[model samples]
Target: MAERVWEPGDRLPSRAQIGQEYGVGENVVRRAQELLISQGVLEGRAGSGTYVAEPRERVRVVRSSARQRVRVVRSSAREQPSGSPFRADMNAVGRRGVWESRTAAKVPAPAEIAARLGITEGELCVRTTYEFLADGKPVQLSASWEPYDLIAGSLVVLPEGGPHAWAGVVNRMAAIGVTVSHAVEQPEPRMATAEEASLLGIQKAALVTHIRRTYYSDQGRPVETADIVVPAAHCEIVYEIPINR
Candidate 1:
């Protein structure tokens, strides 16, 4: 790719052929191709072949602690028509941002999620899964969980279907009288799972950034927890912290 030997959209030779040409094992060629694909240098087409990918700008995800908001931002001045922060972010970058979400109530919390939310396993919680897209291309995924008891009998119980529908976690919790103090996020690099790869249109085992985020109230009580996933090749995460004088 550096030398333009394989131009954008140009199909690469078969693994066997590449291995023979370089006098390496086919497994080596396959591994190298996978790495390049994960880095956005190449893309694999099922039942077709691997091809050099077009240059793409990474989406910027801005997490601002000063305002207690997580949003995507770009330098452009255009504004989105919708009220969603994600849409505003896409509009800034000259793309359309849309998402599909499904919410399930009374879902049993798994061990890991229970730990994050400070609840015991088998506790009932409301879970919402989101698939976010930019310009019709999948870019991110999120699974959010909140204890049922926290907002029981409230209008914000169904995150996407209530009066406060589509309102962010902070706003929703605030409406229920929970003053969200802050959020903590831990990010780690890992390989993608089969389900994630299919949903994001990436190769299985591709590199990705996984984040575990939890929102806490003024009393340090966990109100909500979420797992966010971003394709490493398609997005960049930025943290903006405010320094008090």
Candidate 2:
């Protein structure tokens, strides 16, 4: 006989009753019940038996099809007047200061990541991971990798629990004779991983935006490569293009 569908809050049959009804051993019935619980299809309440749980909506990762327009804004009267492209709408929550709690030992770069960085297998590199929070809630997780020979001891240090401009690192690097000329960004839709979900305080199945950006120096060398993962609901990225003669 087909098992009856149970709705949310519906009381489930006792284990013994279910085993008897199915003409199966208690161990078999218990195993079936455990499977349901692990899948979030059933819940056990204190002082009560197991019950059906409301099904959760499946997370959807949708890439934005709209093209972002960049705008030019004047900085100040004293400075050489130049227009800067800015995003039309960004998340309202401000960054919750840079927290520099270094994560433990570095691991081998994943295949996809290694290709993007143009690094060889088993090469040593320094990895820095950052969690960006808004109002004490994580919204983005960023990981940056640099070859040990290039940025071993001279990396610009971020202040602990203090706010830094999003472009601060690039500017600082320029001051030290590294001229950053251009950047390339790749954005895509992806489901959140377990660690990503926990860091962003979101459901494991939640949709997220994955962005990879590589900044290059005037000398044609890669200066920095950043991988950013953000919650879909919390961010809208804008890019501006200017028609030049």
Candidate 3:
């Protein structure tokens, strides 16, 4: 029947008819039909006989799941995507980058946040949230936390306030004689959470790139930590690793 004696969508012979044609019992023919259906060579519809399936619409699906991972990486930039929605590479020829930030002083850190910052749970920390804009439209969100003990009386503690306002962590820490030695990053891809979706104005469950980072002082003390999120479909990441001889 598959040798072109029948047309596309043609119905195959019944189990009994096929059994007689091949000199086999109906049960044997039934098994072959079942296999064909599973392979998409044939399709069965309720209240109708099986027919040749539309193979052009063939699809193969495979899935696997494992525990989520958190990797310690060398680089950590809140705006890592060189070509993100708010970054320069993604802007149309002449658009400029813009951002709005809100900082909360002495916010109690959550347990998980405390652990990352190497402080006891509920310790006070400075928390800052930012929305990156491209032509006045938001495209990314980031939140950062720094333990109060690290910058208690420093003018740069407020993140976006004081003399060194709007300066990055590396520079701000320098104002207090704290040299930021390095940073560690853990990046992952996942669906947007409800709060993230609402703030980014994207649909729930939309795929996003979430990166968590921790900055350390030269003395190995965690100085800052941050969570940066961007729409996955709109961002592309490029990594540049230096090889030492």
Candidate 4:
């Protein structure tokens, strides 16, 4: 690609062919392609073949809010999308953004999720998985969990259903008379799992930023928790903190 042998949008040689030319095994060629794919240098199309990917500028994700106040406050910035943070970030970069989500009711929480929600193992919860896209390319993924007992039979039970469909966690909880106090977020850098890489169109073990965030109600009860994942090569994270003298 450096020598323009495979320009952007150019289909690459098959693994067998590349291996023969390079005097390496097909597996070696495949692994090299996977690494390049993870670095945004190539893209794989199922039933087709791999191609050099177009260069993409990294989008900036600004996590800004006025949570220092007694109540958690959404950013007043007009740039902040009321519905989805993914949209906000994409908008900042002048790209169209959208997301797809699936919600499952009464799903049993795993031990790790249960601990995060302060619930017993095997307890039921609502799990919603999201895939966020920018210009039709997958850029982020998330799995959100909410305690079933808190929202059972409510109009907001299905996060993407009902009158409040697409409303975020804060607004959905607010509709049920729960006031969110603040959220705790822990961000860590890690290698992507196979599933994550596949979903995000990256290679296995690709670098990603994972954030574990939980929203707490005014009474200090955990309202919602989520695992947010973003491809490190596709986006940069920024924090906006407000200060008062």
Candidate 5:
């Protein structure tokens, strides 16, 4: 049953019914059911019949469509013209999204960040760390860095502050005459670090999807880079790439 007949959420047949079908005694059927449950294939509910357990695996959806759909949806969100992409994504799935952020300026750019932004190590930068919640539960974390030299004096430097609050990388950079021409993202699935696990409220070394995203200017300069961490159990990272036919 575990190998072929039953699915992730299907309830097992009654012991007697299974015994009759398989020509086995009830005790034999009961032992088999217990073994399957212990092996993580089935679960028992109090006062309710046993059920199949939900698989603890990631669900991946790769989109081979136009990326323009994202921008279109962002513009058409009637009430909040500047609503957060995070909130929009959650609302689409009937969930509420909120994020808390702490921003620090004048920090030295870390080594990996410097490479992504094409800057020297120890260069002054602004870092904003965000914890995104869905229905009041932490589900994602984003740590973003931008070279201080680029928008030092502008209000956009304060990511969650000023008039452009919750404004995305594209709009915020545009305020300083740096039109974001494109963004590149690389997603990898790996075990979460101790810090990430604590922040995301999951177990240490739990499965997670790590995303490295960089925004670029029309002149092809890297303006900002971010490390986005999402809990595998709660998030589904989707990509909508244009199919070159």
Candidate 6:
């Protein structure tokens, strides 16, 4: 193994040489080499043979529930002072802080999204798009969809350049006599689409992490469903589990 740490792009010794050096059978040497190749630690070229692979950048994972606390501010330019949206102080924090912004749109949900949200095709949903940034760089984009009937009268439009806080929104809704019970999240990985690449500032070759979360009201009715897309390089997802004895 020590001898196998060849420089990136450097050809590895032939199987015969490896077997002779390690005093192992040819089949044993071949099996060992094959295992390494499968792990991305080695690269094999058709004619050039196997070589050491260059180390790739490590992806950082951040759990949404583990987000750092941020100060909230009220947005200006409210038509009604009572309906002003809350904003966060961007200048007071560094790039590590997650800055969120939201906008509402009326659109048809995609098939996969609709299935996840348990909605019928062509159903009109109130789409809430969230842009999550770190140090002014967009790291993720999420779109939440809810049956318009549920949130139509309760929707509060944010002022220009307002900050986004999901917890705050939940709290406000509760104050209005709406009870939120729990949230469920489903996650997976997929290749980034062209539009996703443009929005996330990542290359098409990079993969993206997709998470769909549904929030249910206390009455066991689904209230909101969100689809979150994050660049593999900039973010990570973590889950904590506890065992009961």
Best by lDDT: 1
Q: What RMSD does model 6 have? A: 7.9
Compared with the true structure, all predictions reach lDDT values of 0.84, 0.57, 0.68, 0.83, 0.76, 0.60
Stretches off by above 4 angstroms in model 2 are 1-111, 155-167, 241-245
Arranged by lDDT, best first? 1, 4, 5, 3, 6, 2
Candidate 2 lDDT, 1-245, residue by residue in tens: 88677789899998898888889988997777656654456666668888887764322222221222222334564322111111112221222233334542345666666666677655556566777644455656778765444544453433111222233335545535777677777989877788887787654645677889776778877766778787765555555554559
Worst 10 residues of 2 by lDDT: 80-89
Candidate 6 structure quality by residue, lDDT tens digits, 1-245: 55545788798888888888888988997777655654445656678777887765433444433232333435575232222111222232333435465655456777866776677767767676777666667767877777665555553333122332244445544644767666678889877788887787655535678887787777877767887787765565565443459
Top candidate by TM-score? 1
For candidate 1, lDDT tens digit of each residue in 1-245? 12327789899999998877778999999889989988878999989999999888899876665444444333376421233546656666788788999999999999999998899999999999999999889999999999999987998899887667655787788778998888899999999999999999877888899999998999998999999999998999888788889
lDDT of 4 by residue, 88-188 (tens): 55666788878899999999999999999999989999999999888898988999999999999999999888876755787788889999878889999
Better of 3 and 4 by TM-score: 4
**Can you tell me which runs of candidate 5 are displaced by over 4 Å?**
1-83, 242-245
66-87 per-residue lDDT for model 3 (tens digits): 1011112133653231212233
Q: How does model 1 fare in lDDT?
A: 0.84
Between the candidate structures 1 and 4, which one is better when assessed by lDDT?
1
Candidates, ranked, TM-score: 1, 4, 5, 3, 6, 2
Runs of candidate 4 with Cα error greater than 4 angstroms are 1-54, 66-81
Q: Positional deviation of 223 in candidate 4, in angstroms? A: 0.7
Model 2 reaches what TM-score against the true structure? 0.54
Off by over 4 Å in 1: 1-4, 66-85
Give lDDT tens digits, candidate 5, residues 15-126. Answer: 8988888779999987776665544456666677778778754323232223212232334444333435676666667777788999999999989999999999999999
